[model samples]
Target chain A: MNKTTNQDPVVVRNPTPSWRAILLCVLASMGSAAWAGTPLRVCYVDDRSGVAADTGIQSFNGFQIAVSEINDAGGINGQKVEVVSYDGKTDPQLTATFASRCAEDDGALAIVGGNPSAPAAAMIPVASEYEIPYLMLSAGTDNLTDMPAPFHFRVGPRNAQDAAAIAELIARQGFKRVALINNSLPFGTDSAHATEAALKTSGVPVVIQQTYDINATDLSPQIGRLRSANPDVIVVFPYAADGARVLRTLQQQGISLPRIVARSALLNTLRELAGDASDGVLVPNTVDMQRPDVKKFFDSYKTRFGEAQPTMYPVLGYDAAKMFLQAIADPAVQKALAADELADARVAIRDALIRNGNYQGLQGHAGATYQFGPDRHHGPPDQNWFVFVQVADKGKHLVAADLATFKPGS
Target chain B: MKSLNTARSMLAGPALILLVGALVPLLLTSGFHLRLVTIICIYTILCTGFNLLYGYAGQISMGQQGFFALGAYAFTLLMSAGNWSFWSALPAALLICAGVALLIGIPLLRLRSHYLAMATLCFGLVFAGIASRWIEFTGGTAGMMVPSVKFSGHIVSRTELYYAILLIMVLVLVMQNFIVSTHMGRALMSLRGDETAAQSLGVNVTAWKLRIFILSSVLAGLAGIASAVVNRQVNPSFSEFPILVSILTIAVVGGLGTRYGALLGACVVVIAPQGLAAFGESETIIYGVCLLLFLMFMPHGLSGLIPKLFGRIRRKAASPAPGVVKAGEIKP
Candidate 1:
């Protein structure tokens, strides 16, 4: 509770301090809440039951898989990995609360979660304040790793990378003009901004750009405006249901322009909602499904979780959990744990991550590896993190599209 | 005897609440617990404003969170962006909230009951949208950061902030007690009791409603500042719909018109989930059930039930023993 931040003018100038000493004694004791135990604890702070729940739920599923595999394989140096889960409900303030709660109340060694950027940003300061190691699953908003954060790390492609890839595809296809439409959520706005900037830089002029409310059921006006702009291609940033609505309106208006969704809002629900209208929409995907390990992991995820996310979500989750769990198994971390030094254990875990910096898992491009050090947190962005795919079979499948030669609806 | 009861409700109730609030830090040993209690104080302050507006003034606003967010942003921005001191930033924030409420309340106070609720809800949503969309000023979804308060060339600590928020909440309740004890308080009760009748009885209904609205909004702003100081951060989540609903729930479940109901409601809404393991992940469900149960069976709310129970006990105490009918028997 060392958070006194009020502005009392008379009190400030009165040259007297009230009740500062006793408060420190209490907080000092509270800071020692973390105690070493047989079962090591980590907290997963994610949106489990909100609009983007599938992403969080799938990531958590992958996180659980790693925990189970590790515990089954004789634990992290005989100490089983335990996970405490919190549903952030897509709110950053709520996420911050969960972060602090895990640090001070749950005594979590590290916190790993988030499928969105805002919540991820919220966790950073709290993690820094509490000195808890935090690993984010998939918050690819481009600017998250703009500065160096010692205890915070992320595993995902940047929105800027996605935008640049889409722009390259658009230029390669020789499209005349592009129209960009997005939902008004932060994710959408951010993606649209990035994509617009990339497009402008790539010599493709955006003919029209507009945003609709996230919950708007009727998008005919926006779709009609899209038709009026008469762009050769369209890039949309929409969540599942809204994506369906936009597609339906596109069909109704008979605007059969080539549509490219610039981000991860392309979900199974979109295809289900849009029916045949979602047939030819293209998406920039994170998972390169051709890799044997990636394919096997996706197959196991499908068999285990009832449905795979059909994206890079599970990989990101699995990779983060694997790295964190493995880092804790080091002899240095075990020494701190044996001594019941929770504070030292946290610092030890951070050091272990830096020592085991070349963490290779099923995330990023085929050859990409994770890194952590004093000056690096998010690591070097993998330029090849993206793989292009097109929606086919009434949204039942996403077939790989060779951007160099693929044409729309061919 | 009536004066005794009035004094109990006015002075004694708030005094006791303040006493308990003041002693929470020493009793609770954990920083997390202290943090939770500090949050509880913030929510209580927020519900106080809501209580005055909806409870006494006979207005229901689904947009209380809007005022809350406005206050938070104004305070944070003024302090962080304007480099204003905490003392000056607080008054500026309150003034901004009052100004906005006054401008809106003039046209808005004309609407009655649910219509007003709908309009205010829209206001809340619009403000939330602006907080999220207006990225440059509010920091958008990432939220704005607040600097810690310093005093006399020294850093003010967390304990001081906790006490500061607690003191503010108690003062708000005391002020509320003071407000309801005056002639204007009677007018407010009359307005809530029957608006048309109050107007006929020579009450300046519109003027009173506007004043209470401004007052309520200003209080909400104060709460936002307190919360920002505690978290040292303010995000769009401060103005989201779930928060607005929770505040309304606190008002309804604690009995709409009572003075101490805000504290009771804040405790239920804030402490209930964290206190018990079974309540985890089911916070929303518990709140729904609590609201529904209170609405259906105890229509008067928990605050109402307490007094009724007390009255029943008092009435039973005054009843004469069944076998002791000496006076009547002597007459016979």
Candidate 2:
């Protein structure tokens, strides 16, 4: 056997490629190009299984719909876009862990969706650490963009901007004394601070300020304090469930003051939970669904989700995905990608977003337009991005308030 | 010869654990895995403390996460607002946690079993509530950024953090071994078995319980500060129900009375989720099933089953020819 091995050296030295092998190699490359296009992997992190599952699932549905739509449209530059989603469970640590895995292990080019502010803020360090772009979908907290977050861009309006807009609406409505009730969470606290600052600037005195725990079932004491203050209007900052609880408590106390709430309170779930109490409650409207484009998108969303109507959360997700896709589709970004400079392409995508100021989106109908710049990471530069809507007809309808009738300076 | 064998047996578990832990960085170079292992080390410290209280002292603390959150916030506040060094903030955080634990344990540890559990549960809720509501100091629900642990004019990298946390955990394990081998450990063990009987046996039951409680809280505080420094962030949710659940689950899964159980449990609890992460939403269901199976079959936990299995295997190997007697052996 040793003699045979020594004598077979010439046999092992070189084997020229046969015609069959050449054919096989050609066929393999052709099959690869035909069957599997190069995929652009992006990571979607959200709270899909825990406390925030409801909103998280909705945001994911919107994201999935956008992914399908983009893929259906031949994908970005004909490269199939794939999303690797990880359920963050609304835990910041878990979110950070998954974000790191997504960037480091999965080689995800971008990350999107941190529905709540805490997880969104958690993703900032991860984004900076990994040098990947993160798009904020539903988290409206200002702290996300307050610092120098180079790779972070937000599609949602900032809490401060929304609060200031609501304050202006209050001023326009001639409600001099406004009482504020906010959830103790960051979103609510930040909104409360912004409202207080805006109200102070507008010379509208805040009669009372109270806060309730995020999931407080009984807000009677808080409502009682608000009622005793006897303000002309009460502005509340909470999500759907807590906002409904507050409205129900106020109704039980027979307090008839005009109530204004953040956009989150306008959710369909809140209307269902609050029942008749939600009627006449004012909410900031960032998207006019009546617009043709928005109506078309809403109809498609309802059809896709098999529902009668879609909520603002899904729309926020849809817009966020679209914005990311559009940014990546920019000629400069595509050029970088084609050149195989992935890091440069990521940076180019971010710069493209910043350069393309005032990009019209589905939210534009309601004066909320997506824009980004070196100084402005938050979307929707329009300060009056929100108009007021009053729930009417036993919480079944939302009618636009007459903001045009009252002069802003008057 | 017996003494040498006994010494080998005693050092085997820790030596194996240290070898495994030391091999992690060499095996995986990704920051993700490094962070995960660092977190596991922190959890090991926490579980060791938890086992000391729940497994040895017979106390159920549903509020350990409350102590954890306190330590995190205390460290962050001291470092940022008070401008304290990492070394200074760490001890301060642990000291504060120990002092608070003493005061609360004095009144709270008087209750037994489920009542004690309920009280601790309430403590956790109240801690989370206070942290979330006190926006001025705690940053409320938005959470606060933690400064990096700086040493010798240089920020500690992830690799350095791994070693630092590993050193602390090793020291904790050694201390735990010392405690378990000593009379204080026996007193705590007796308390776990029967508090009334232990009291009758001249054991200062209440004092022992409180001492263990303080020690456990300090360990938890140390773990929390380490976590804050490693993650570079702190939030109210750190003390919420999920964290409490994690602490309790790891302790129960690791084994009750064993010293190495804490380390074993930390590995399972921390690594299992990440390993099963590919299952997505169904991951929680699968994890629940795994825990249920472990509890139903291995009631003493994974660590508790090791010795019994090993003893059986050794016995079988030694008596390979049971029916045949050797020349020097007497047949029965």
Candidate 3:
């Protein structure tokens, strides 16, 4: 039985270029921009027009929708938020340039970007140099959250979290032997290594480990090797398109060992591409589709972006932006904003963000909370941020697997 | 006197550009603007080196990106991982790149035209693959962070680094001119015009090609180091085929065979897109349209056309109808 609510979908207006526009009159109740008596500036450095454009566009829409929603209902402490956006084009150098611009040129109080770890790697130095608080929407690289980076925080699962969560499920399923495979992406390479390490630590024998090049045509070789190793279950770390290829290749080879994959495999395209082969593949997912707030967010995304099916990216964006807005809403940050002290406001915002304890956002599973501090910089670095979901009916339906009682062949 | 005048004309565009480039940090003190200009300077070096190889030497090797990546990774790994000083790391990176270029150039120079291009393209692709797969050294696709530059005991500030890169850019320009004026420059031009004729004229074709290839790769390595320091990081993206495409775009846009083509091309390629950043998603479209316009109308490239246009305008002004006075000219 599905319980439904009547919350209206998000409304999108005429597209407005989000570069520099002079702040308009706001009621005295709503706060004004800091330092310049302008609207509060935040830069969203996204990869909007490159190989990973879909993920970037979804993230931007989610971020923009949140800004719109907040503005529609009296902005943060009445101070409207302005997002100065940049399309990084997936170039790390370009991303670095834009991040530098976001800090020095745009005078943004906070910076947000980095889905893939490459741009995040570029942004991390800029964030540290400028002392800007950078919140990644979704990056699985563990070092991106390395300690001593007070300014860096992430909203989604880390490589370790995905690895640990999947490893736990594999162990729970009572599978005696496991095989781990991953494509040679930052996420895949890092996650596969982490997953292997986790499995090794859990005393589970990894029968085989193989790394495939991204965009490889025939994974029959890899599948053949995996089959020869005779793994009871296969764990893969790959993005959607490649994950589909892996499924197709496996199906072609008639290998039916159940597979477990990382969060990227849960992208909407995976379901479309994998089709029937996606049936029993497991994914360490960040957001559950059944939650009411998730439903509301999905509806809002559909209304705003015009697509009913979106990947996990928008949810990552929404949660990160919300947490950032929440930090700015702190009283000390408000005081800095009210005094029109831009530098003080930026520092206060960073300080407030690092002090974040127990931030419950939309990206994580039920009861997952973030305690960001000096030691715990990765927003919600815990494994609870991910839940295991088995793709059923070509990703048309999902059957949530209970970690405690997960059966091996179900 | 005529030779002196030609030399003056050659220096004019570059000297003026360098003077303005020197004043950029003074005028705009923002970190972002400084970083953007630093990138432009690095692009200048890359385009200049690429221009020498492809534009003038008639070698369309797409392997500069591989050299660039090697330089960046080598320099960063030495500094951060090996704890080597900046002074030693810079030259080591350059030398390593030159060495690799020399080894590859011997056999690669034997191929003609597209064969060479495809082979060098594969070289770059292989380097990028290695950069990503050799995760321990290159950090895979996540890239590795570079430590702030410290020469001797003093740390180089951002302003200081910008000036240093500007100085290097100016030096590269001077080197380009120097190369062009030397006897070897004539040999290069001859070879580019007709390899058979140059060979007949006693130019050692393979040796010359190898020498220029090594020099161009060293320049690419220098630019790569400059970029790594400017961004304070290096990733496999630096060596991706897309980067090769962009480098080629800059080379062609500036006109392959002009004196100051790289300088003009670097400005257009690096700065134009930043200006269009305000347009959001349409930025790419606007940039493509601008590039298309340049390709359509300015086949001679910006570096080659501007001076001729200026000369025509000056001549028209000087010889204004035998008896009529132009504006600002007084009649007796």
Clashing pairs in 3: A30-A78, A31-A78, A31-A79, A33-A38
Best by DockQ: 3
Which ranges of candidate 2 are over 4 A from the true structure? A1-38, A183-190, A213-231, A253-257, A308-310, A335-341, A364-368, A390-410, B1-10, B152-154, B311-332
RMSD of each: 7.8, 9.5, 6.1
Once fitted onto the true fold, the runs of candidate 3 whose alpha carbons sit more than 4 angstroms away are A1-35, A307-311, A392-410, B151-153, B311-332
- Residue pairs clashing, model 2: none
lDDT of 2 at A353: 73
Clashing residue pairs in all predictions, respectively, total: 4, 0, 4
| Chain A TM per candidate, in order of listing | 0.86, 0.83, 0.86
Q: True interface contacts reproduced by each model, as a fraction?
A: 0.19, 0.26, 0.40
Cα distance off (Å), candidate 3, residue B107 = 2.4
Descending-DockQ candidate ranking: 3, 2, 1
Candidate 2: clashing residue pairs, number? 0
Write the residue-wise lDDT of candidate 2 on A47-131 in tens digits. 8887567667777777767777887778877776777777888878778878877766556678888877778778877887667
Ranked by lDDT, the better of candidates 1 and 3 is 3
**Candidate 1: CAPRI quality band:** incorrect
Least accurate 10 contiguous residues by lDDT in model 1 chain A: A9-18
* TM-score leaderboard ranking: 1, 3, 2
Q: lDDT: which candidate is best?
A: 3
For model 3, residues B1-332, the per-residue Cα lDDT tens digits are 97887587657766887797776666554565567678778988988888888777888888889998889998999999988889889999999999999899988999989999999988898998888778777777767888999867788999899999998988888788878877778878887888999999999888889988999999999999998998888888889866787787787688887777887777677666666775657889988887888889888789778888999999997775878777897888
Error of 3 at A95 (Å): 1.0
How would you encode candidate 1's per-residue C-alpha lDDT over B1-332 as one tens digit per residue?
A: 98778767778877887787687676555566677678778888889888888888788888888899899999999989999998899899999999999999999999999999999989988998898778777877767777878877877777788888888888888889988987878988888999999999999999999999999999888888887877777877788876886797777677788888887777666655443222445655765686788889987677998999999999998876776675547533
